[model samples]
Target: MEGQRSKVSSCSFVSYCFLFWVQLLPLATGGKVPALIVFGDSSVDAGNNNFIPTVARSNFEPYGRDFQGGKPTGRFSNGRVPTDFLSEAFRIKPYIPAYLDPKYNISDFATGVTFASAATGYDNATSEVLSVIPLWKQLEFYKTYQKNLRAYQGETTAKGTISEALHIMSLGTNDFLENYYTSPGRSTEYTPQQYEDFLVGIAGNFIRKLYGLGARKISLGGLPPMGCLPLERTTNVVGGNECVSRYNDVALEFNGKLKKLTTSLNKELPGIRLVFSNPYYSLMHIIRNPAEYGFDSTSVACCATGMFEMGYACSRGGMFSCSDASKYVFWDSFHPSEKTNGIIAAHLVKTALAQFLE
Candidate 1:
């Protein structure tokens, strides 16, 4: 009778163990991890150009010296972009493939998302200026992706996937940089403030579109301190060793307006998550207190020219290049270094992701 009792107790213990393991499975294997659907410009482009014919390509030398493989991975940054670190903090994966990449691993799309088009912006004219993928094209990609996802995971599952995922957007800088600043067409139509308003309208439209497509958690990035970037500092502006405050003012104004708009949007759409990552604040803080951020050369870039030129303009054979990249904040004329990306990613994780993901 004692043996029989012992056998029953063992069976009960085994059942408990099985249940415990079942409960721990998701946490153990990181099961059904929330997806990170990204959409933006070069600042967030994760090797999208590898599949495009755009001249905005960055899969070349001195682009990824700080990356794990020490080779260009088509990221506009010197190493990893903000999305890379954000994905890491989320514990999804390292690299998020561009939806357009011919080699894109579809299986991973279940856990990750990328619609960022390099050199793209809210304005249609911006794409023409850069001869790169446009925001409209990116949206089209998303539309097609929604179909593919439904096919892959079924309708109910796909809707749930999109609803649960975090939709990240970091655009508008290019609209200002390439169009409002340089292009004849946009400049003729709108002043700086007018252009800002127009772009914000586009941003709002984009958000609404995402909501229509079943996205709930949306993280829209505010423009960085554009005045401080090497590109803005060097190009066209006169007698400015320092950054142009006009650009910074525009960023501040746009971000402020967007914040207010988001509040209203939340009330309009209940149970929706709308987060804005203020890259303006984070980038401005580092620019103002470069030493504190561990960057001695905040004004200069590590690439050629080391001061103003960025993207294709920052070429080694054409101009000068710096030795150590760690000292500088700007990787080229436009984007942040991998270290800065890490810093920005850390803050974003806490602010934009922690609560949303939870």
Candidate 2:
């Protein structure tokens, strides 16, 4: 009884701290952020994949069923993703449009835009396999965005917006899962550690390029526990549907090196505020304590058959699609439900965003 009481007290104290930091966030940052610039994979893709001819897309029924107007917006979730929550938290906007979407023009981009594409990664080969936009191509679109911003909002405003914007990069899961593990060629060419180093080097160069283009406040998300995904669990039937420990071990090791890279970059670059946003522990906590986050299920997704359905396979017409997505941690095999994304965004606001904003 005493041990249980102590545990309850500790949890209460942590909750209080989280709420305190959330309340202090806006005041600490002075005013609303100028914009929310994003670059990465399906995690932050917004709706860019809708315009591209790719098999990895979610621009149809059941994808954005929980979002406003009940229309799919190419987001890989049942509703808004983390970047949408981050934009609102920073008082930027409710939604961040895709840079490639024709509906949004220069004025719409002045505040924010995502150049991300679904199924992309730090490795160009990963994007090639899926016929999605590569990170380098995203960078080119960002250059176009800068030019358009300069033309529409004038040079001074464009520079200030780009400098003050909260830039976010979320990639690498596909590099390991979709490319390194699936492709015998990549696996045969380099070991896991070597591949991680290669990806990190590419990430460093990308960040340096963003810095050259006038970005300062940047946050790069570390890899999650890939082994814990429903797809991974289903594929690991030999292990009795358990989370593959070896895959998770690789993620932990990569995150350690990525964190060190961020520290080194902070010292090496002048006036650059770069942060490594880690989601591994937080997502693990939610998976372990789903009841605390109002989730009834964590091991399976809410879409289609729950075990492996994703992208077009997880559709509204599927017979077994869950009636309530809020009860599940994941909407599809690989993406989190809107409720889970909200919880993760809140965690990032307190841990990662606050530090750089301060």
Candidate 3:
């Protein structure tokens, strides 16, 4: 009995020591573990869209008015996007490169971040709406990124070199916004529920691809309330300032299906961490009660046209511009302001990432 007690005690002591050393790993090293690899649409795009000739690009005036030197780095927001905030909160640098940017080379991605440009959606049709980077293309970029990382760090070290790396994904809104609802090309093809399933299937396939690519930490995002966007609210719909319940319902259905898929993925692919950030619920709550979140104008874009009020075809030079970008919740018809993105980043960092990072 005494011998058994001693063995158990020794095992417990060794486990405690191992955990203690693991906890001290970051602090003992002195420098932070760097590198963030982001993949998503406008929400997390740093400046990849600038390289593309798409009309959805945001590398113009009023886009980066809040950045370090007030230069539009191609982010859809006035300043740093969610990826920047997430990197900052994690104590890494803020300027991550867009994977497609010419200035970015293999070395730039070693310590910095990379945003793959795409109107990226769970559905290809949604990706085609604006000719943004499709999910497959984004995965191809990741393949290139991995190759570059391996070349720089060598094969053995590169096996899982993405320590502390976070794959921040913000997509699927375009699937509903452009494909199912607005785009004439796709609207007639699938019912709203069919579209949701199609998107979820795409999402699942994308996640599986990421898992195969050694993406252990993935933050998949759900759609925001589609009906609440200023463009959606003011469009040809009969209602005034009312969110499109049908679109939101589709999003809800997608979220439910996505949750189930995530559960299955976690079980099937052990050691791969996949989390879904429910921005839909959070954004909807804030939009419905702007005062609660300190947002003064949740329904309008701070840019010239102010939401869909400028028509579905509003641009930077449309009509008017707000003096303070922080005062507004959205930068354009389909994008959120830097402040709002920061808020969402904070929530993601605090909630979705709490378990993984710690």
By lDDT, the best candidate is 2
Report how far off residue 193 is in candidate 1 (Å): 2.1
Clashes of 1: 0
Ranking by TM-score: 2, 1, 3
Clash statistics: count for each candidate? 0, 0, 5
TM-score, cand. 2: 0.92
Whose lDDT is higher: candidate 1's or candidate 3's? 1
TM-scores of the models, in the order given? 0.87, 0.92, 0.85
Q: Pairing residues by index, what is the TM-score of model 1? A: 0.87
Task: Report the lDDT tens digits of candidate 3 across residue range 124-239.
Answer: 76677777788788888788788888999898766656644566677887777766666776668777777777777878888888777777777777778877887887673687
What C-alpha lDDT, on a 0 to 100 scale, does residue 24 get in candidate 2?
65
Please list the C-alpha lDDT of all candidates, in the order they appear.
0.75, 0.85, 0.69
TM-score of 3: 0.85
| Predicted candidate 2 versus true structure: per-residue lDDT over 71-106, tens digit per residue | 789999878888887887776677799998899998
Candidate 2, which segments miss by more than 4 Å at Cα?
A: 1-24, 27-32
Error of 2 at 43 (Å): 0.6
Q: Candidate 1 — worst ten consecutive residues by lDDT sum? A: 1-10
Better of 1 and 3 by TM-score: 1
